[model samples]
Every structure is written in structure tokens, then in C-alpha cells.
Target: MTTAKETVAPSMLAADPLTDSVDWLLSKLGKHIVMAAPLGLGKPNRLLNAVYRRVAADPSLKLQLCTALSLDPPTGSSSIEKRFLGPFAERHFGKDYPRLDYTVAQRRGELPPNIVVEEFYVQSGAYLGARQAQRSYNSLNYTHVARAVASFRVRVLVQKVAREPGGTRLSLSCNPDLTFDLLTETEALGLPRPLLLAEVDPLLPYIGGTASVDPAFFDRVIDLPGPTPKLFALPREPVTDADFAIGLYASVLVKDGGTLQIGIGSLSDALCHALILRHTRNADYLQMLEALSPGLATCDLVQAQGGTGPFIQGLYGASEMVNDGFRSLHEAGILRRRVVDDIAVMQRLNSGNA
Candidate 1:
């Protein structure tokens, strides 16, 4: 009596050859497919490359590449910023993801009439602000991925992940954020049960929290044997003195043991650093705060809620991105709180009654 998980695991393990698994999945899928975006180290590059090859062979198949943050090779523009960053990006990324097939075809206006790309977010490059990209972009919220999936009748879902060697469980790695939502919506709508394909690359980091999946969830699995795409790295912006002061002042407003939802970029980095300083170097942090806001340190709110004291319970990171700054705080033993997404639970936690 084999359970679904047992059945699926053995079948996936038996489908060893990458091309065989890919061809099998492709045969099961409809002409239209939706893929998760961003060249996270976990992205199924080999599977995606195979899909592009298939699309190339079959000119009549309308394969729409729907996703966000499609990465591009750095442009060798004459602008000073481009001139400075271009070589650095080349040195770092090399020819790893030289070009995504659809991106290249779209840019060259050479896409077969049946192939198109729809992106919700574009890379922050010269092309991003251009009229064409702005017009073509979907401007859909991340929450609406399921809606888009149903609307587009997306018949296949391909995701990449980290697999425990010889284990049936898989980690969504960097993108569990949207995978669950998309899966739920697809199921709820009773859309044609899309073929679920998971690609495992050994190089992906196994991140916890809502990021894991079981073998039963995927219809097929392919193990890519090669160098995985390098993790996309964002250069840290230097924090200005004024920015530091502002961050110091802002840090005193957040109560200890509270949840934080921060966006990525320099300001968020500065705030995290300031919070670390307040927790570890109370006297110096107080001195800086006093100098910046005069009497802010002596305020009742600051006295009751905020203090130049080390976090005994630590803070929770509930940001859209668990970027390098969050990783830094985690390493420093600061961001250790975990908050669930239930409204009632959050209400109790906020009221300090949980």
C-alpha cells in the first residue's frame, strides 16, 4: 500500500535523466505556462532553458513567460554610474545567466508570434523607466499572482528549489513567499490541475519558514547537474551621517519585542544598524540620541517603551525581503522573534497577552 508521497517519491527518483523528465512534463502541460520569477540561486535554469528550446522548435505554441524581476546583464552605457557598475557586474556575474531566452527575443523583437513575456516588476535599469517597459509591465501586486494564474489559464507551474540529498522533502529556498499563495489559488479555482514541476539544484541555500514542500505536491522533479546560478547580490549603500542620526531617532520609537516590517535599501539598513547599536552600546547610543533630539532620551515613551538596553527577547523580521541586513541582525543575535500571520494571534501578541 504505497501512499501518495511514496508513489511520487519513487517516480521522481526513477525519472533520473533531466531531458526525459522535462519532455514528460512538457507533454503533460498546456501550451501556456507560468513560471515563478527572479534568478534566485534556486531558479530552474536548465528546465527553463529546455522550455525555451521546446518553444523554439514549436512556433505555434503560445508560451507566455509570466514573472517578475527578470534579471539582465549590466549595460555598458556611457553614463558614469553604468561605466562604474558594468565592469563590476560582469566580474561578479560573469556569463552565468548571460541572457534569459525570452528576454533576449523580446529585446531583439524576434520572439515568435506565439511567445510573449509579462512581467509585474522589471529590473531597475535604464529600460525599466523606458516607455515601452512601463507600457508592457503588468503592474500586478504579488498577492494577485493567483488571480493572474487563473485569468491567464496558466496550465503549468515550474519552480526551483533546494533538495536534501536522497530526501523527498524540498525547500523553496528564496521564494516560499509566493509559492503557497499561488498553489492555494490554483487549487481553489479548480483550474486544470497544472503540472507541477520542481527542479533541484545542489547550490541553493535551505531557508526555513513556509518554504518547504513535500514530494507529493510536485508531479515531476528534475535534478540539474551543473553550476547553479549565482545568488543575486545587491551592493550595500553607504549610510550618511544624517541618515544615521535619523535612524537613531527612529529606533527609539519602536518598542522592544515588537514586530518589524521593513523594505530593502539603505534606510532600512541604517535603521537595523541603529537598533543594534542601541541594544549593544547603550551609553554611546544614548549620547548620539541626546545630541540628535536633545530631550528624546528622557521622554516618557522612550523611558517606558524604548531603552538603551540589549534585547532580551530580540526583534522579529517580517520584511518582504530577508536581505543581507536581516541576515546581519540574525547573526548578531538580535532578530530572533517569529510572528505568525493570524489576525487574532497578532492582535494578542500586539497587546502583550499572547
Candidate 2:
């Protein structure tokens, strides 16, 4: 939130997600709302709902929602499926996890005429049956998401953030990727600066490196009082035999010193597990590779590009979406390479002189 001199803290002072955030947003951006939300766990569900409810009630107000990977707790089709999935959703996602209002409304075909939702990516097969979601899907390259969102003249960026020590500094902990890039892109294009908004959730780990940010970055912020909201956690799918085989074959292709990136899910989990096994238990890993298929161990691609060895040098992680995959890697000491943003430092590192 804007600096309030009356308060002791420079900013990041407490405010109501329902009233304060929505009211300030309307005041800053006017009735016509164009906003972007981060993918997955970084979305501010409560704040977004507040805004959605306000705009949906008024026929004069307009909203164009741009985002990717709109996450929703799964509700099974059949009664049997619902019985199993109902508790599964609650166990993985907390008892009172808030789902996006607009997404639910849109999926139900009850979204108001004034409100439009656009997404470049959706959960695999989540919206295949929903005609409106498919029709309104904003197809574009992953690298161009920020530009695509900006192209629609989006003027508000709302993201979930975490505290950076002493509760003064803020980090776009889960979603530094888009917020940092979008603002840079918008400025490069010489457009009016977007009203950057954030909802602080202290539960999120305070990540450093590129994710570390200052409180001054936000135009407005709301740290809702406790009982803090529980972030929607994706249930871990059991790693299948096919997944392990794929991960093993894929593992050999990675050199000892290299950059690694992985998406979320059982497959990525399998890969990270394989990599760790390869490093920590080389014999067992190699045995599993051979057992899966003799041809995999002797494959030319595996021979040329990868090998059955521990990552003594480790790997640098650089991916669009950093989630649990990266976390596992970090914990295992496989993601120890520090790739700084400085070009000179990178050049030196690339030249093998760092």
C-alpha cells in the first residue's frame, strides 16, 4: 500500500482484503478494471474475489481478467468420485481454502456479461468440457505472457507475496517471475505504470536471490489478520513405473554440470528423485536404469549427452515456474549453482572462470 506516514511502518501495514484492497484498487484504476494474476499458488484468491464481487454487482463496472493456470479444487463428476475427492481436496487443500470466484462462476456459465476471463494455460483437461473457458483462452507463447497481458492494457497486477525479515520487506516469493518481468516490459513500452498490489501470506517461505523484493515495490498491500489463508496445495500423484523409466532415461541425458528445469507433478517428482538417486545412490540408480531396459543404458543419446554419475558440480535452475520441484532439488544439494542476474558475472561463469 502507499506509504502511510501516520503509521509506524513505512507500508505493508494491515488492511482489509475485502474493503481496503478493493476500494483502493477502484480508486487507483477507476471502474474499468484490467488485471493480471500469477499462475498457481501465487494468486491472491480472497482479494480477487473481493474485486470480482464488487464489479459483478454493478452493471456499469467492467473487468477483463488475464492470467494463466487458474487453479481450482477438483470436484469429481460421479457421486462415488465426489465421495473420494471431497476429502482428498480438503486434505490437500485446507478445510476452508478459497477457490477463485470468477473461475467458479465462469465454469458454471454464470459469469456476468461485464466480466471476461482470459487464460493462456489451464490445468490439463480441467476446462476441456467448459466451452466458455476454451473460447476465451488467450493462446500465446509462455515467454510472451507478460507482453500479451500488457497488450490488453492491463493496469493492475495482484499477486501473493511473502515477508522478507522483520515484516518490512516483501518478496513476490511464489511469483516473482511475472510481476518483475511485466513491470519491466510495461516500462520499456512507456505505458502508464500498473497498480501493483499484493496480499501477504507469512506462511510462504522467504526465498532469496531473484525473488527478494522490497515493500516499496507495491502500490498497495493488504496483510489480512490471522487465521491466515492456507495456500492450495496440489496433491502428490503416485509415481508410476512408466514415470520412473522416463525419468531414468531422461536423467542420463543431463551432464554433471548443467542447468535444470522441471514442471510440477509426479513426472517432475520422478525426475528429481532419479537425479537425487543418481547422485546419492549411483549403484542403485544405474541398476534401475539397466533393469528398466538394457537398451536405455546403452542408448547413443544417453552415452553422448549423459551418464550414470553423481552431479559433483550440481546444476543451476532457471525456469518460468519455480515450485516444489526446485524445492526438492535445493534440499538435495543438486540445485546449488547460483546464476546471478549480472551479465558480466554470467559471462565469467560461462567462460569457466568464476
Candidate 3:
């Protein structure tokens, strides 16, 4: 078994210029290439663009790009809401992602006849509601990414990450979600390990967890200096009074020393905020709770598991995406509990004898 340290060591040769990397990848191309998507913040845009150029140069070379959540800049829309959001989205996210090659080709109805772009999770927008996207959409669950790649006969896998400063090992900072699983699946099936490519950027934060990959795993490495592409920050949604009331109700059921698995968005934010308020501003929080639903604060379940008192043991976060809300909760000293993975230890903890 490969140890963590061995698996995260820098062992591959680096390509200094973008062209060298592109040429290396192009030479090993198969009919299909699977790329990191939706989670496109960590995607290798330069290398993919180079692939697009190659496809443009050769009309008969059929290449299927399989991935999900291909984010595109907002184009004009007819609906009033879209009209307002379109310009706002463009003003913020347009220049950063700049005419993503496949999206542009898809929008202009000029994708090469042989080059097919398939997205499992469509970006939610007026653009996706159009005829072309709807016609080309391949609906699938996120868990089925490996199966999709296998079905498409994908022989090349490419993703982006942060290189350990002055090292070659890459950190899948924002998207260790699927790449590891994809690699595992391909390996288990007795398939030749797909040609792995890593585009190393300097700007991505080297987050912890199962996010590191050895340079040996990658067939080629491209070092692109300067700022990496900015991620599409899902703007925090505004919280309403009703939303806060619901959050207050939900917060009372959560055990003080339990784990949290909150997702991204306004509802999650409201819930976390309510929990923090319940801990720090208990009197005010209880008053609001009383006004929203009298006697809820006095329930036996609430009395046992919830309270206005500050967290003594804190809560552990075990979420897929540790969003800004979790960061805030950490800052407020509420998310400090750490869980271990041993069954015997867990039993001891549950029995309050650890």
C-alpha cells in the first residue's frame, strides 16, 4: 500500500511552458478525455483550450469531453429576472472565465461535428434552458461519473490543482470530490491507468483532507505561473424573517456536541447563523423563538440536546463542501470537535466514557 507521504511526493517532470504541456497531452490523446468540471475552479483551462485548438485544426478527429457543470457566462435573456441577473453575472464572472472554448462553440452552434461536449450536471441558468443544451444534455447522478467515463471509453484524465510551493505534487484544493474516485475505479477495472495530466497553478489554496496527489500519478505536469482562474463564488442568498424562524426551529433539534453536514446556500447560512446566535446571544434568540413558536424552547428534546448556552464541547463539521458558513462557525469557536474513525472509540465516546 502506498503511504500518504509517498502518495503526495513530487515525482514527475514539469513542463515550464504551456505549449510543451499541450504537445505532451496531445500526443497521448484517445478518442475520449474526461476532465474535472462544475468544480471547474480547479480545471486546467489552458490545456483544455489547447485541445480545443487541436480539434479545430482537425475535423475528422472525434473527441468527447465528458464532465458536469460546465459554467458559462450569462448571455442576454428575455425574462425580467434573467435580464437583471444576466448583466450582474456577466459583470462579475464574465471576464474571469472569458469565452470558455467549449461553451462558446456550444453557444455559437459551431462545435466541430466530430468534437462532442457532454455535461451531466447543467449549470442552472437561462442559457441551459435553451434548445441546444436541453437537446445535448445527458442526465446522471454525480456518483455515476466513473461509469460515464468508462462508458465513453475515456482514456485520458486531466484536472487542475495547486502545486506544493516549489514542488510537483498537486493539491486538488477545491475538487478532490471525484478525481480520486475516478482514478480508483479505473484502476480496479484492470484498465490501463488513464493518462493523468495535472495543471499546477499558484493561486489555489492548499486545503487539507484527501486532496493531495503524487506527481508520479500524473503522466504529465504543466506549471502555469500567475493567478489561477477565479472560482464562481455562489453569492450568499439573503435571509428572510420566515427563513430565520425555520432555522430557529431546526437549530433546537441539533445536539450540542454532534456533527454537522450543512450544504451551501442561503438556507444553510441562516441555520448556521441561528445556531451561533443561540450560543452567543441566547436571551435574544430565545425571545425570537418564543415569538415564532411559544413553548418550543421548553420542549424536552430541546432541553436535552439544545440550549442557549455556549458550546462547551463544540460541533464537528463533516460536510462535502466546507463553505463560508462553516468558516464563520469555526471563527466563533463552535466547530472545534474532531471525530475519529474507530468503532470502539466511537462507542466509548457515545457512552460518555472516552
Candidate 4:
């Protein structure tokens, strides 16, 4: 039987950027056992260099490093640039230290060069307690992910975890709601949550999620006042006249003060800008009640006035990446949750529910 090495270090340095932390990792665990790091928000290249320097100097400690570099599918660099240039950068220093690569969630239709691009799909026997685990599998690729995780014994280390309805998944926030969502998906796939939550100092509260979960779920909780892997808020691109033309149509359906949930895209931004323009120019943008009586038979007049509906009390975003424009709407109190799940409810919420 092969003896497991004593004191294995699964360094998740990608989540946070701290030199002392990296140095401590080097001193204790050396540089060989580190796997992948999340490069969305930190000085990842710096960490990689430090790891390389250590590994290059000591022939006995050649390590394999995995990285999940951020790539925007819509308008960012193409797949060829990402894959070809991405791995080339790390391996360019020569055989002293080789490059380790992998792909993360990317937009559809992009074919990355050199590196293996993972596909998105639902797995079998992964529907948690649903009737049929193999029913209408959305994508066969995600199922492969489940198979790999089960086979490879992958471990996910993070600052927090949550007990979702489907199962527990590592959570990067205090938000139980978000935890529930991630866990539900994993549980459906029959995969145990591979999260090592509350194992590190300095917990970070992600801005997007509900931000509430039980403290007992954490193994170790330390207070550190800094954002972990600070991500740039998704950028808002400039809109064109064609964009405005589309926005006007979408805007015509919006209720004046009703809650709205806009999906991600140029159309959403245009709609927002158009709404602001109407409110600024027409002054008839705010909520107005019927002259019958105060709060008697309240109907969203804003909707009638080419604004959003009144009963649109709240908005809940179901988008994958929360961008700046979405954040702006939330901050402006235009986004809220709606309990109704009907077409009327949706149409009433946004001027153009379709």
C-alpha cells in the first residue's frame, strides 16, 4: 500500500492575496502539492512566480499548479488567445517549471485553443430527491464533471459553506440562500459538497447572495477586515443608437415605480438608460394614484404611462454574473422580489415581460 504523505498542504492561495500567507505555505508545505488557484481577483501571476521560483531552485520539489483564469465569453479575448497565450505564459520559463491549465465556466460557442475547455451538462443520478435522475439531462458535460469529482477525490477549500436544500456546498459567503442554491444543484447530482469551509482566517461576504447562514457550519472562523479575491464589478459597455431603439420598446412596457429584474446584455442597459431619460424629461415617471381615494384600488399608473407596473414590489435577479448595471438598479430600489409566478405577474413587473 502506498503511504499517504504526512501533512499534505492543499493551498487555496487563489482565493486571497497575502504574501505572508504564501510564504508561510512555502515554509510549511513546500511548493509541490499545490493544485489550482482562482485568478479572478488577486495578484495570481505574482503567486505563480513565487511558486515557480521555489520549484525551479529545488529539483526535488517540482509542483503541479492548476489555475482557473477568468475569461469573459461575450466580448473579452477569444478562446485562442486565452488558451494558447495563457498556458504559454506559465510554461515560457522552460522545463524548470511547467504550466498546469484548465478551463472554467465560459460562454457557449467559444472553442479555446490548446487547453481543454469543459462543457456544461447535467449528470445522471444527480437530481437529489427528484423522481428521475436521468430525466431530460440538460447538458451531458456537467454530468462528466460529477463523474470526475467522484473519481478524482477533488477537494474545495474556502472560507465558508452552506447547507442547501439539496445538500451542503462550500459557500464563499454568509448567505444561506446562495448556499441553498449551490447545494441543491450538487445534491441533485449525488455529489457530496467538497467544500472545506471555515478553515481559514478572514471570511469574506460576497455582495450578490443573501449573506446569511449558520455559524456552526464553519470549522474555523476568524475576523479579518478585507475583501477576499476582490472581483471587478462586471463592466457596463457603451450602448449604440440601435441599442437605444430596442431599449425604448422595452422601456415602454416598464411600470413607473414597479420592481424590475433585467437579464444581462446590452438590451438591459439600454432599457435602464431609456427609463432614466423618461423620468428626467417627462417628470411623469413617479407613481400616481387614481383620484377615487387614497390607496383605494391601487393600480400601477406607471405601467400605463410607459413605465413599470406598481404591484412590482420587488425584483430578484436570476442572472449568472451580476454586473454594474444590475447593481445600479438594485441600489436604486427598482429591483425586488415578486411571489407570483404567472405571465401576468411578470408582465406587470416589467413593462415588457416577454
Candidate 5:
């Protein structure tokens, strides 16, 4: 374990497989470990479970998970739902997708007393009856999670990342939500930089905007030594009449040359579908709009704030979370407006200067 007093050149740091390095990590970080992981898809399940196992074996070793959205395969409760979801989960997650040890233990009411899991966000209704989960829940706003996690004085930071074949850069892929901010916040708190471990998976898409980072960012970039485990994926839900109606209504409120921020769900899918239709088939969209509500087409708010027309100038994505809806919008040529954080550059572009 590299300490605050030591210096190791960042780029030259070598990765060791977790199977052989868990003991090494424990030896380095000591038993009183405060670890951080990214929410949602960025968690490195195998790496985390290895550490969790260490604490479970020895009560003297203390472990506190400072993270959110600990994912588990969708195993339905009722017999009927289970029957339907069993095969589905297997198909998406494969037979050997490593389960988060804490999720399983918590749900089964067998979590070790020495291990504490503090999550600021969780899957909807995932822990309604799990007393341990409820007691350990940390209720913090999403925007403030970085600060809260930093306050834990995280000793290790483990997350999944994307890599281009034979390429040097690693991208946060599905989750860049809080990792960067956490680093900044940790520094602001006058704490040592956490031990950064990057888990590489082939399934993660190589996304560019604000997601890409240099190799030096990580202390080690490790991958599962054998056949790679499948990343957890949720099947897309079918759109319904109510979803379409809400989507159409929401579509009219989106200005053509504005920005958009949407999350994954049937409603967001429907909205993206409606936006594509508004661009590709304007006449049919108008017909549906009139059928849904004749007055909505003439609403003063809609008229001024937005328009029921194709997006010629396109829209920009200003969201922290990225999903398939944004991908579909980009494919349809409606999500083409790129943005930059530089104020002067934006002003120059807006003023039509080279």
C-alpha cells in the first residue's frame, strides 16, 4: 500500500489481479478500511467482493463501503416473477457474473456485524424490508454525494472502466458520475489521494465526452485474469400508451436548439421516440399531437418555450448520466450540438468568430 508519505510514479504503476492481490491490498491499506465505489454500472464487483471476503473471515478487520447503487441480478421474489426473470437474468448477466457479497448477505440477513455498507442511493425498493440496509442508509442528495463520500476518508477507490484495444486511455464508460468530483472533494478536505484501482471490461462502451482519462489517473488497471465476467445489464422495457402520451407532451416542451438531460425508463424511451418521430415524420407527429390534445398544439407556453417542429439546429446533452436514449437521439441526428466548458470559446462560437 502506497502511503501519503511515499511517491510512486503514476503512469508506471503496474496492475495485479485481485485474486492474487487482495492480501497484498489488505496488507498495504490495513484492516480499518474505508472504501469508495462508483454508483450504478461503474462498480468493480469482483474486486469489491474480494475485499468483503477478507473482513468476513476476520471480525477484527473493519470494512465500511462508502458508495451507492450496489447492483444485484434481478431475481424476482414471487414464484411467477422469478420464473420469468430467472432465464432473463441468466441471459443478460451470464451464469458466472459475480454477485456483490454484501448485497447477498444483507438481503439474507447474514451480514457480518463488523462490515458496514453505507449507500447514499439504492435501487428502487431493493431494501424495503432489509433492516441492516435501512439502518446503514445515508440520505444525501446526488449532487452532494461526492462530498459525503470524501468525508469518509476513503482508503481505496475501485470502479469499472472502458479501454480501447491496445490503446492507452481509459474511459469511465457507464459511470463518470461522481469519481472526478470525489477526487476534487477529497483534496479540498486535505486528505491523501485514495488508492485508485480501475477494472477493465470489454462490454463497456468507449464514450468520449468528459469520460476519458489518462493512464496516470489510476494506481493499477486490472482485469479479470480468465474469461471476462459479463457486465450487469437491464433489458429495455416496452413502451406503453401512457408512456407515449407523456413522452409526446414532454417532447413539445423541449426547445429545438436547447439542452436535454434524461434518465433510463419507459417514459424517457418514449420521449426519445417522439423526438425522432418529430424529426423524421413531422406530419404524423402533428396528427398524433392533435389527436392527443388539439389545444396543446396552440398552447402559449409550448409556442414560446418550444416548437412542434423538427430539430434543425439539434440539441446538446447536459446530463451526468448517459443512457441508450441519448445514443438513439445521437443516431437520429438530433443530439449533435457539442458543448464545451470554456466560456470564451462558447462566446466566440455564438458570435460566429473562428
Candidate 6:
């Protein structure tokens, strides 16, 4: 029931080089010890057994065992999510563990009893068009789902909590402070707030687009763990030639040195792949650039300043899930954060300001 920033010492990095400043910053927010065993905890799973016993031992705390398993370094295919979390839940929680709720940013269906799921939606043209086709277009983005959930009059958790120094931080334990911003907005719209509880996992990997949140407003800090929930790969439709053709067309909207905020899924991947190929093969496009700016057209300038290489220069992911593909791009040193979801950053990339 509080909202304020925090400050702490940068000490952990001195012990382990791998200790990230971000990790330390996130630790300040406390999270709940949801007594449950995940499929595998990177150990002998002994901790899992211990946690299960602790949960069983505690009568005061309600144990809504969850079977949702997030596979680390997800690979292979979409079905991999089921392959991991499904069996894990079957073995551990069994009957007590509730079913998984897979919806994103919007709760379209019912969730398991005692198990709360979060859904937040931002206003988009397409969404409005589908719901209110006759309404005129507006220049502002609005939150539709956030409003409905807030009407339930429930406490919602938020992951972002800013520390005193300057930079923002997430709770290391992954527990987030709840806020009623969305609910307040709903109230403004004359809706009743629903009875709600939002479990914020501060350690949730921060994304780069509309998904960004400020790290200063939270209610309670619970002790959640790092690498929060692993996204189980959901099923995706098969890709076809037409899909690629459309993706190629969409790729045209992007400029040569422009920054991109790629959405999740295969379609986005197709668009990225096609763009890379075009950059490699399209001599006319390259020449057009050379004609425009002789300094920028040279091979050396293109390679160094323009990030002309065999792979993509750098593209930011603004989506929620930081899937394996995004990880790969990050590991390859192609991912750079100019700042926290800044439009100027994107514009600079597009104009080749770097």
C-alpha cells in the first residue's frame, strides 16, 4: 500500500561479474514465496520438494498450485510450452494446480479458481474499428481491457519501481507493487472497480515498445524470483507463401537504417528475414542511398556507421514475451538500448543518426 522510489548500494557486482546492476535494482521489491515446485529449478529439484513441503505445512496461506511452466531458452516449435510446463504441473500440483490462463493483455475467458491472471489492453485503431466501426478515428491511445478489469475494484500489482538515484528498477524477487492507475481510469469512465489482485513480477524482462512501464509506483513488494514466468510457446498458424509476400510488403514501410519495434510471432520474423535479404541483394536501393549521401554509401561507412553486416544491425523488441529469437539477437550484440522506449531513439535509428 505504498508508492515511492528506492536506493541501494552497487555491491553484488563486486563478487560476481555476472551480477547485473539491473538485477540488484530489482531485489528491493519484495515478492511472495508462492509455495510450489516448478518442473525443474536448474538443481536436483531438491528446492522444489522443500518448497512443496513448506506450502503443504502452511495452512494460513492458500496454496493454489500452478502448473504453468516457462521453459528457459525456448526452442524447436510452438508446442514446446506444453511440452515443458504441462508435464511439470502434472507431476507436482496434480489436482490442486489450476489450469493455465494463456491470454495476453486481455482476459477473454475464465481463469482457474483462486488463480489470478492479468490482462491489460491499449487503445488501437483496429480494436476500435472492430468494436465500434462507425466511430470516428481519434488521435489518442486508450486502455479498454485495463478499464474493465479495474471496474472489478481489485488491487492490481505493477512491476516498475524507480529508485532514488535516477534510473528505474524492477524488484529482484519479481514481486511487484500494485497500483490502481488503470482502475482509476476506469472509474473516470464511470465503471465500478472489480475485486482484483495483480501479482507484479518486477523481474519480468523489460520490453521496448508500448509495453514499457515506469518504475516508481507500486503498492507492495513481494519476494518473487528472477527470470519471472517463462513464456510457454503457444500454438501458431502455419506460415504460407502469401504470408511471406505480405510480410515483404510490410517490410517496405521500414527504412534502410531505421530502428524497428518488432512484434512477437512468425510474421514478424518473416518480415525481419526479408528485410535482411533485401539489404544484401538490393543494389538499386543501396545505390539510391549512395546517390543521396556519398559519405554514407561507401562500403566502410555502411559497415561501420550504418551497421552493414551479414546479420541485422539492431532491432528492438517492444512486445511482452522476450522469446528465444530475441535472446539470440541480444546475445549477438545486435541489441542496444538507446534509452527506455524513446521515440527519438527510434527516429535517430531511422535517420541513420548513429
Best by lDDT: 5
Task: Judge candidate 2 against the unseen true structure and give its global Cα lDDT, from 0 to 1.
Answer: 0.81
Model 3 TM-score (2 dp): 0.81
Candidate 6 achieves a global lDDT of 0.37
lDDT of 2 by residue, 1-354 (tens): 434311122244455546766777777778899999998888888888998999999999999999888889999889999999999788888888888998888787788989999989888877766777888998888889877777777899888888877756777887687877888888888898888888888788788877876677777666676577677777778999889878877888887778887887888988888998998888898888878878676678777887778877789987876678788888888888768889999888877899
Better of 4 and 5 by TM-score: 5
Instruction: Indicate the residue-level lDDT of 77 in model 5.
Output: 75
The C-alpha TM-scores of every prediction are 0.80, 0.89, 0.81, 0.42, 0.90, 0.37
What does the lDDT read for residue 252 in candidate 6? 51
Residue 327 error for model 4, in Å?
3.5
Candidate 6 per-residue C-alpha lDDT over 1-354 given as tens digits, one digit per residue, 9 for 90 to 100: 212333223342243211222222223322222211112111112222233333344443222222112222212236877687666655544423222222210123322232332222222321222322112122222234334334444322222222223345432221111223454665786754422211333323443333334443333333323443332234455667666666555545554334566655678666655555455556654454445446453456344444323334455555434455456556654455444457887688556784
* Candidate 6 structure, TM-score to reference: 0.37
Give candidate 2's error at residue 178 in angstroms.
Answer: 0.7
What does the lDDT come to for candidate 1?
0.68
- Which of candidates 3 and 6 reaches a greater lDDT? 3
lDDT of 2 at 97: 88
Residue 20 alpha-carbon offset, candidate 2, angstroms: 3.0
The lDDT for every candidate, in the order shown, is 0.68, 0.81, 0.69, 0.40, 0.84, 0.37
Candidate 5 lDDT tens digits, 1-354:
444222122233455466445665677688788889988788888889988987899998999898888889888879999999989888898989898999999887789999999998889989878999999999998889999899899988888888866787889886586888889999999999898878887788888767898867787676566677887887788999999999999999999879999988899999999999999999999999999999887899999998899997799987767688998999999998656779899777666683
Worst 10 contiguous positions by lDDT, candidate 2? 1-10
Segments of candidate 6 deviating more than 4 angstroms: 1-219, 223-231, 235-238, 257-261, 280-354
Residues 1-354, candidate 3, lDDT per residue (tens digit)?
112122221234344355555455555664444443435565566677877777677875666777766656566546887878876886676445545687777766777777777777766663443555566778887678776666555677767777777665668876686777776777777676666667676767876556876777666666655455565555567988778777888888777788888877778888999989977888988888888889988878889876656688889998757689899999889998767889999788767799
lDDT of 2 at 17: 45
